[model samples]
Target: MSRATVHFLLRSDLERLFTTLTDNQYEIIGPTVKDGAVLYTPIQHSEQLPQGWQQLQAPGAYRMTRDNSQRYFAWANGPQALKPWLFAPREIIWQAERQPDGSLQFSEPAQPDRKLAFIGLRNCDLAALKLQDQHFLQGQYRDPYYAARRKGLLLIAVNCSHPADTCFCASTGDGPHAKADSEQPGFDLCLTELDDGFLVQSGSEPGDQLLEQLPVSPTTENQLHQQLQQALQAAKQQRALPSLPIKDLLAERRDHPQWDDIAERCLACGNCTQVCPTCFCHAEGEQVSLNSAVSEHTREWASCFSEGHGYMAGHQARPGIRERYQQWMTHKLSYWHDQYGRSGCTGCGRCTTWCPAAIDFPLEVSRICGDDE
Candidate 1:
């Protein structure tokens, strides 16, 4: 219906897509079955995708089941997406060495990142990727590391037909369909998986060129009928974040009793921050050789729950779990709006899924900030 190029790839010819990326020298990463769950891993062949398997997710529960339907990308998402690849969990930003005269020599990592093709990307993660780009690539100071990795990256998004119970991107307006704009933050190509084939829409020049080489067919009206409805259907969620100005509400309730109740249940294990696609808090340190001759400046992911992360110049800003929880929630839901023009959460619900405390985040937010204003 739109001006985007649409094509159909039969179930048997899925391998052509892999071959195209490989020929273009892009390393393929896709969802695979690992350790009883679906995870992103190196996928060279089409057979490596977790076909017919769907992952069921809740606030703190997860299970994988096989439907034997031979469909690829039948799941919503894994614990993490797109973040780790662009933003390394641990990396050496620059290294210093002691010279012969006891002077210091510094050097930054110069290796260019390999081109990457991410298959089965979800729309919620796509939204988060745009936010990450805003943080790293669009500001006064640009991060060379994130910029280098994102330069040659190719995104092959998948529309959700079997989203997890934890998924709430429908309410966030970031999921169930991938945007097809080449001049904007959109996918290179988006695929909607059906029983016998995939409905593919090309969104960029590289994606369009790739489609021209593949053995795809002009989709028929019959093929476009009921087969793709589930993917197009707005995915419903059991939980929803209150659609109001959460900033003033959270500012008003900074010391509310609800904070105490949440602190009692929150383990402050940093699980939520670790899995959060948009959280950018990190700690940098200098690693030195035992002889103190050579040193390397490195940065690693850090969470607000960490006591050290709360340490300010003279004292700790957030000394207790209550304050830490409040800070995380407020920053994610409120501060992000002030900073990014949108909430930090894309509503993928990974923070709730991987939380060991079994904390339902949206429910907690509602209890604390939902209409009793």
Candidate 2:
């Protein structure tokens, strides 16, 4: 439909699009080859992308190769997601200065620049964003820091042109394509890369506004069909992950042996939770002036896998490594939906890829559910 849909040839017109975006003073963040890994980084132009390059990844393994395809998103999910930029690694709470009179003055942390436009966002990441919005934005106690950084940011989602070995987004019912419509718009612009071109559509008012600047033609019937075909093709290649009724499974496996096995290999490390886009858990701390004149509170990212995360009143609730892992998994895969009306895990596969033990989640589920007998 010409009303809001448009198409552009991927090879010829994509660079122009990037140039147009930069012209608007938007800091474009996209995939680039850095230190032999596909990292989401800043790019001055489209030349910085992994042209004719793609990555094949699985638990404990990630490799790059030339695909001979110029698709901007030919590769699957990368190691680092888009969360680090949006949700900072660390932020100063407030700075305080003491005066000669022993009085102290405090200043709040600086907010993020408002003109960042994220490109190559996947469906799983989008779902993760939704989960974070529920926790940080819609909650009774809104996080002013997160709220300020999240506002006025532009989302440029790309449909998965290739599904990775570790991905199970379809099992989570969030994958390959952006499913939300006008009332529930998830992105500003959705790009589906075709063999020679891209199928572009605007999902929100801002998206429509952005689209007007690019040289996009009305989406023809054939392009629409091609878009569906590409999506279905990616979907068909998805590995069949078992649909474990998470709530029931978790309820029965409170003391399962899998916890012990996982702990033995897990290192009690929090890499999975840290890399996860949907993880919103954090802990707060305070710093006081030397003269006790002023105090400033700070919030830092926390994880369930950490030794001190469950600590309360000098006693940690889940002491054992097994117990902590169980709690994290149970909350993420099962109880999170009940508490927040959405699943905590977005099937982004960053957990498996980044874990030292190469912990395959689907394999874990299979172990818990038992194999075909």
Candidate 3:
């Protein structure tokens, strides 16, 4: 409500903000239409932001349509989120070269740290980002790549105005509006999309300083509340995960018949894991040159559903789809609490949206844990 903290930005003002980010040497990345989907790409201008285009997402379904509206950030989430940016899908951790003197030299690629500003971050994405930070930063072995990228990063979040049918971030308490508490800061700059303009708020010191440079007009408390009502109501989504913490309950139902039922429709193609915002499993291997002169150690995203994911002593622990599905579900709702002190799922519904076989995990969880009763 305060003039210094909250402001209104017109279309031209957004362009000015883009210009400011460029001048500050921040690589601006935002949502743009690519290959029939909204994807994060280098944004040079405000016009690159997906405008008048919205998505229809349901279980195992995603399609784009033109609504002829004058609003950006009016659609549900796409296939990806901030996970791929911070926790890269594929990265070379280190490399080794065979030496002439029968000794090997180990080296890492010297890619300079980049100052990145990610725009159009959703509330669920912000929640997912927090979980990612916990995984990569709070662990015994902090990932240098994630730590370096996260340090100089700026997040410009957009409040959800168009939650999809598959979304359940509300039930997860992550929600339509991103929460920034005294303990943990959320986004750098948060925006609520409106028809004529955007309602902006600074969530961090950097955001405050950045907003000072933008061409934004002061907004009143009444105006802010009135406009924010719709975004808050967007949290009342059609889908919701169980409100209760079924961590222990899910573990007890390891042999639930529901697993078999869901597995029949599941292809175990790992589509859900790949699209999920918080799934963090990865496969690491060494890539050796044909001449044995060079070796590169790489880490790439992996899924529990992968046949090789549960390999131990030349035998697959979860070779069947039912076991794999059970493992994925339990880790998300049960094991995550033990690991991160909270659920791993952000309820962005990307897994539900992109799963080719239409395996709706939320409904499946209810059925498996007997929460539907």
lDDT (C-alpha, whole model) for all candidates: 0.85, 0.77, 0.86
lDDT of 3 by residue, 262-373 (tens): 8898999999899888988999999999999999999999999998999999888998999999899899989999999998888899989999998887988888767553
Candidates' RMSD to native = 1.8, 2.6, 1.8
Clash pairs (backbone) in predicted model 1:
none
Runs with alpha carbons beyond 4 Å of true place in candidate 2: 1-6, 180-182, 219-222, 237-241, 286-298, 370-373
- Candidate 2 backbone overlaps, count: 0
lDDT of 1 at 192: 79
Runs off by more than 4 Å, candidate 3: 1-4, 180-183, 220-222, 371-373
Per-residue CA lDDT of candidate 1, range 1-373, in tens? 2336578899899998999899989899998889887788888999999888888798888888897778888888888889998899999999999999999999998957688999999999999999999999998989999899999789999888887887778877787667665466378888878778998887777877777777888888877775456745647667677776677888788867889998999999999999999988899999999999989999999999999999999899999999999999999888888898988888888889999988888878888887663
Over 227-338, each residue of candidate 2 has an lDDT whose tens digit, in order, gives 7787888786445447667666876777677877888888777887788888877777787767766677777778888878888899989888888888877788788978
Clashing pairs in 2: none
The best candidate by lDDT is: 3
Of the two candidates 1 and 2, the one with more favorable TM-score, higher being better, is: 1
Q: Is candidate 2 or candidate 3 better by lDDT?
A: 3
TM-score of each: 0.95, 0.91, 0.95
